[model samples]
Target: MFKRLYCNNYRGLVNFEIELDELTLLLGRNGSGKTSVLDVMFALCRLLDGSAKVTDSSIFPERTLTRWQGRKEQTFELDVELDVEFDGSVQCVPFTYRLEVEHEEGGRKARINREILAANGQPLFRSDRGTVQLYRDDHSDGPMFLADWSASALARVQPGPDNRMLTRFADFMGRVIVCSLSPASFATEAAEESERLGRDATNFAAWYRHVLQENPGQVAELTSELRKVIVGLDQLSLVKAGLDVRALMVSFAEEGSKPYSLRLDEISDGQRALIALYALAKLTANQDCALFLDEPENCVALAEIQPWLMEIADSCGESLPQVVMCSHHPELIDYLGHENGILLSRGNGGVTRTSKLKDVSADGVLKLSELFACGWEQ
Candidate 1:
């Protein structure tokens, strides 16, 4: 899991460090930049995987400067500590990936100023736009030139004796999953199996079907878990649509009545949202990845949200991907407990600030949620 994130001059983030746990919940009012925190991580993943196009015209970073403070040339530094199987043994290591970007020629272009990767506080590789250097076990491989300033040299470089850190970092970054739940995709007709769960779960039906096929008995387990919260939900099955079309269908029944079935759209939006999240949690239960959910309480019923989150929390074990969720729901804040809650609030200057609930002193009289409701400040 990610240990800490230090972001400087990135959008609403102005030199802030967020301490993370296995399951961190981002809490703030609307427009407080809670989602921006998650987006920064997503942007880094894209950059490490060679998918980010850093420029004045790009969708990400909308602007290089922090709007309120008028700061420019963002620097993102991240620390991730995880255990990996290395040399036939399990070893825990701390890895840091730092990236710095600057605008050139009066905002006409954006370029990378520096990129550095380190392990256990030792520099493994460091590069500037002009020259790239590789260090292995504390030895430098001299300076190597880069052809393109826009592309990431670390992402494009292949794994060799000297640069296994780059390979490991790239592999981890490639698998980080950031998603905001989608009900439309859940209700759509199946096309084919998905490569991975899309950002908005646009391929949910296909991915669900793929998981059912690849891991037999997994669907049955998911159905059993869903039945606990959604009392009437008996099972989730696939049905043939018009002609050769296929879609996911859910079946429900009263205590002594015949069962009825509904397609994704036929059900309430809240139901579809819960079902999609349930399937994703079950599908990724045993994988190594990072899952980020943005405002998961959007369509979910208030009463059911607690149980739904509890179920997801139960499914995520130590070896599985860690989950980070952004939510403003008071019940969600209560469910996360005081230790896991990170408060994000915009101050007078429109700059966002982050604080842990434990760090804030309370009277020991009010519940965590109550404290959050009353402005979190004494």
Candidate 2:
């Protein structure tokens, strides 16, 4: 689980830092940098897991630098706590990972300037430009070599008995899920399995296929939960559409008629969102994966919001190790603000800042959402 995040000169997040809990809620107005925070985490995860390069324009464009700051350096840091089995006993370990990217040639290109990963204040991996230093689990220097300046050296490390800690950290980062679901972009057909879910979930069918293959028992539990919220939902399955293509199919049972089925794309946006949410919560339970959801309340019915929130809340810390959500819905604010909310605001210069929701003073008459709607939070 993420204990804290620090970002410098990334978009509006200049010198931004936020402490996180098991279940944290980000509450703010539009353009307050809530989604940007999620983007940074996702991009870093992708980079370190070898799925994306630091110079990938789609993930880290030149415009990602703060517009007002003339500095060409952008820095990001994360503090994570994980429970690991060490020396035949499970122990909790604290890890810190930091990366600095420098834009060159007037922001036309970017490369990693420095990257470091430490466990319990001991360096596990360090890189400066092309010079790299690797350390083993026993805190001894392992290897020193030159690495690609635009890619993650940690991702390229080979798994070995002496480097289990480093490999475990990499695996944990690979499992971190960050997404803002766009059901309209969801593809019904999947040509092959995807190990990672897309940031927009456009490849949801392929990702779901992978999930079903990896955790069939969890998929069954997810289907049972979906039936309660999704009207008449009987089962979810993947059927062959072509020689190597499969399509996600949803079955519904009616009271006085024969059961019917529909393609995933044929379902309404709300139903799709609900199914995705339920699947996300159920399939990843107890998997040591952290979830970051951006505005999950969108496209969901007002009445259904609280129940799903409750489901997520019930799973956090036990079934789900950590979850961070961004929302503007009143149901979410009233239910989670006082306990798990972090209020984000922009200064006059457009720099983003964060404050704990419980620290904000209220008249005790209006709810947190009401205060936000009336601009009291600003």
- For TM-score, the strongest prediction is 2
**Alpha-carbon deviation at 66 in model 2, angstroms:** 0.3
Q: Against the true structure, what is each candidate's TM-score?
A: 0.84, 0.98
1-378, model 2: which lDDT tens digit per residue?
899999999999999999999999999999999999999999999998999988787567678989889888999999999887878998888999999999886666788889999999999999999799999987899999999988888899998989888888899999999999999889999999998888898898999999888878798799889998988999998999999999999999978889999999999998999999898999988778899999988799988899999999999999999999999989999999999999998977999999999998878899988998998876
**lDDT for model 1:** 0.74
Give residue 104's error in model 1 in angstroms: 4.4
What is residue 78's positional error in candidate 1, in angstroms? Answer: 0.8
| Candidate 1 structure quality by residue, lDDT tens digits, 1-378 | 788898888766777788888888888777777777877877777667777666624324436477676545778888997665666787777899888887654566777778888888887778787367777634456446664666567777777765665577777887787777777545467866654566677677877777787666567767887897687998888787767567888899759889998887788878888887777677666657788888777788878787777776775555355888898677887788576888888776777888776777767787777876777542
Clashing pairs in 2: 286-319
* Window of ten residues with lowest summed lDDT in model 2: 53-62
